[model samples]
Target chain A: MSLPTLLEVVNLKKTFVRRSGSFLKPKKTDVYAVNNVSFSIEKGEILGIIGESGCGKTTTVRMIMRLMNESNGKILFNGQNLCGLSDEKTTKVRKDMQMIFQDPYDTLNPGMRIVDILMEPLHAHKPNMTKEEKYQKVKETTEAIELIPAEDFLNRFPHQLSGGQRQRIAIARAVILEPSFIAADEPTSMLDVSVRAGILNLLLDLREKMGLTMLFITHDLSTASYMCDRIAVMYQGSIVEIGETQKIIDFPTHPYTKALVSVVKDLNSFIENRETMILDGEVDSTKKTLGCAFVSRCPHQEAVCHNVVPSLEQIDKVQSVACHCFGSSKMGISERSGALV
Target chain B: MGKTVLSVENLSTFYKTDKGISRAVENVSFTVEEGEILGLIGESGCGKSTVAQSILRLIEYPGKVVKGKVFLHEKELISASEADLYDIRWSEISVIPQSAMNALNPVHRIGEQIMEAILIHEHVSKKEALDRTKVLLELVGIDRERWKSYPHEFSGGMKQRVAIAMALACYPKMIISDESTTGLDVLTQSQVIALLKDLQRKMNLSIILISHDLPMVTSISDKIAIMYAGKLVEWASTDDILHDARHPYSRALLDATPDLINRDKKIVSIPGTVPNLVNIKSCCRFHTRCPFAFERCKVEEPELKEVKPGHFAACFLEEENHELTYTS
Candidate 1:
């Protein structure tokens, strides 16, 4: 049976006003950092938001966490509109939802010991708890993350620990309160491959142990495919594609998604498909567009693609795409899907 | 493989920190052939960058290459004077630093930077240098019209292209690309990798592509060298290393990377953190986390031995028949 949706984001939008062109002739333009982005996460499901830099993946998560105000749309968590809640109410709601940042070194405080760092949440949430009770809870959480002999690391500072250990501590802090929903923004991007593997596996373990509904944000398709149950491809502040992980990688429909899949650095495909495909130009999120944002770099762009904006539409039961030319031309959905076979 | 363009032997570099001496690169030895790409794959703090820096003789204060020899094609570079090294820096061996994407001077024009680099190594006139800069830009598939633009004016991909262009200005025999595509998006990374491969073939230039992204490195490198805890644990042809890895660390690293095609394969993490570099023990560095580590692994270090015809692995598990006892 399909799980009930725990978090649903509807028509989310965020815009930053750019006041530039010198102080003499100041120009104000609205840059749509996130435009009408929407997705849902089921309880105990891992939904990965994959994209390049400045694609509004971070901004979307920030809005969902209510760390920053969204310019428009709804953030519904367990059927409650989080955007409409008061500061105190939102703060209470935030306890069940935690965030893991990209860089562990930067996110953690340098001066605090490991115990103090992990205890801040407990102290804030349970102000009247006994010292013995807090210590037992902290010890259990540390052991859960496999930080062996919790007593050894409890007194040490963040700097005393390695990059991998620091990240584990960060995860420990996040799950200390036993949050139901977790948003990890490139949690392992800054770590080494071996260390990254540990962190990724830790996240997976924590999800199973805590029954977490996770939103994983990353630019890496390979990692996303490995970890995520459903993958959402974001581009220029919009989700160009979203589907089952395997289906998306095997038969990508959107031009951007197809290009992303092709460039994944698969060692086996290197010789045969050395020069297979490459999307031209960089992502420009500054432009105010009435049409598709990927038109400038897309190889399958038609005349109509430049003038008409394509909303995400379902192509099948398991897949959806936001492209007008997806099933329209010879380079359409059928032809592209044929490539997979 | 072509003629060995660069050979490093017993290269040991150390950093004198307040706590103790940290051996960042220890007795590392490897060879890079002309017109070949040698991939250096390692985790962070594994001395991958240290090895690269020691070769270029770029280690700063509190860090020194205590012992070793670096030969650029047959000439010894370690004993060479700083003045002589300057001549070989850009002309003989150039470097496209890891952070080169944003390494461009924000104040100066892109064309001027490339031109200045050319003029520094070669006694070319201002006009000739400028003309050569345009050609270099074009060679890297960058628009020559944007030569007058500043670094910030260009995109991340464009900045990377300009960096590659600058690296090519001197037509060095060898180029050291240290984590060139680390922060780039996948699409841009592929483009850059393709550009580097194309340039390597066209110019017959040797490259040492150092990166933590193993698959990306394996895609272009003719040979791969795996480093762990400031030591070379494995070295073999890209295909051999990828398919028939012998070192436990290498196997763990391969397993750690999530497979794209094989969905059922679970990612097995190497337990424990990297050993502290300060006053490192004599035993195998990876033994602490290696699943198959035996009693011998705890007491003695294993040297890199040729387990197969072309593949070498530093491990005690490999028998004479090339059978590994460690099961994944």
Candidate 2:
């Protein structure tokens, strides 16, 4: 039996109209920053959205957080449509959803003390709570995030603490309210490798303790595989592949996912006959395409991929891939299915 | 390995601060041979970049290379005159900085910037420099005609490639790429590393790739040097470092790093932060975070010694016959 769904994003789309050229002749082109992104987070599950820059992973999260209004589609949180909600209702819903930004240096205010930083969310959300209660909650959250001897850190400023501590403070702030869903966007990428593992483990610990559902966003496949139960590979504003972490890494169906999985350098990869696919050209998000988004850099691009956009299709019990070749015999889908069996 | 291209001996750089002197790079010794790629792996503030800057003699006031010698092709660089250093700067050794966006001038054309390096170092005509710039651009997988475009016209990966082109403009014998592929995406980073590897093979150039990325470094570098708290903890061939890392810090780093292939393996982060370098004691720098630290590690500093053939590790545990096993 499966856990209850906490957050479900359905066919969400976000487009930014770019205005270029002279004042007299402005070229207004529709740049689809995010197109038809759909995913859900089960209760107490962590789903990672993995992609490179300009791949719409951030925009998708921003849209889900209601930071940016979506151009189309529905976001059903707890069976309630978040779109077209009033400001007050949206603010109420935001208490259950909290986001952890990418950069810890810019996220936390420099002048604020650790106590003030952690208490800001409570002040905003729980206005009726007593000042003593707020301070007690701050100490408790600080201790929960493993900032031991909480008194030593609560009085200090963000600058006095290290990069890893500042990040822990940031996490304390995010989870201070004990939200059900947390969106962490590359939370550990800014940290060093040694400190990064600590942060990842802390997030896992928080999820276990609070039973919090999480949307983990990162570009590194290794990190995503480690932290996430399910992985979604995004390319130019679309989820090309989404599946269980092991299945996605072991038998990646999409060409982009295959390329992404191939490029990841690990210790064991040195001894293996690694067939690395060095894809040319970067993601061009400005251009609107009727065909597949990854066709420009994909290795297995067929003639039909240029004109027909392939929808996400269920390839197995837990794997879903958006590729035209998956259904047809052009790219050995049967061979992949045979291996899967 | 071919002939020695660059050799750094007992190099120590310290930053003068209000508290005390911060030893950034301490008694570091390494040699880069011709056509060999050396991977310098370390955490932030661990003196990886300090070593690169000290080799180039770019350390300014307040931060000085107080001791040790840097030699390029048997010519001393630490004691070289300003004019001699200026002549050898890009012509003999060049640098691809971490941030390619800021390394390049926004107003100038990419081709003009690359040609500037060539024209300043070599007695070449403007037309010859332009031709050479075009060739360099094409060599790094950028279109020759795009040289006329400004920096903003290119993407992040293209800008990094342009930086690589500028580094190769003078035909320098050695290039120091200090986290050049940091901000780029995975595929783009792989492409950039592949380009550098290809250029190294074709031109017989030596490269010192300084990054915290262990896997990427191990995949490309002939030798790997692991640094911890301004000290060279371990230095060995890529295979040896991968299979037989002796230093506790190196083993901890490899364990800390998440791997895609080994999904079942648990990533254990080293507890505690890196020690402050200011007025540091003569002890193992990684003792605070080392899992196997003992009384000997807290008092005595372990020197980098050859534990095996072509493998060097700085740790007292190697002498104690502590059988270390790394399960990848």
In order, the interface RMSDs are 2.3, 3.0
Q: B38-62 in candidate 1: lDDT tens per residue? A: 9999988899999888888999989
lDDT of 2: 0.89
Q: Which structure among the candidates has the greatest lDDT? A: 2
Error of 1 at A173 (Å): 2.4
lDDT of 1: 0.87
Give the poorly placed runs of model 1, Cα more than 4 Å off: A127-129, A265-276, A338-341, B319-323
lDDT of 2 by residue, A1-341 (tens): 18989999999999999899999998998898899999888898899999988889999999899998999999999999999999899999999999999999999999999999999999999999999999999999999999999999999988899888999999999999999999999999999999999999999999999999999999999999999999999988899999999988888888777767766733233123223332466667787777988887776678989999999998888999999977567457564542421
Query: In candidate 1, which residue pairs clash?
Result: none
Estimated TM-score for each candidate? 0.95, 0.95
| Candidate 2, TM-score of its B chain | 0.97
Q: Mind giving the per-residue lDDT tens digits that candidate 1 earns over A1-341?
A: 29899999999999999887987999998999999998888899999999999999999999999999999999999999999789999988888999999999998899999999989999988788888889889999999998989999999999999888999999999889899999999998888787788888889988888899999999888899889999999998999999999888888888788777866635335333444443457666778777899887877777888899999999888888999887786566566754622
What are the per-residue Cα lDDT tens digits for candidate 2 across B1-328? 5799999988999999999999989989888899999999999999999999999999998999999999999799999999999999999999999999999999999999999999999999999999999999999988899999999998899999999999999999999999999988887887788789889989999999999998889888999999999999999999998988889888889989898888877888888989999999989999998778789999998888899987989899899887765433
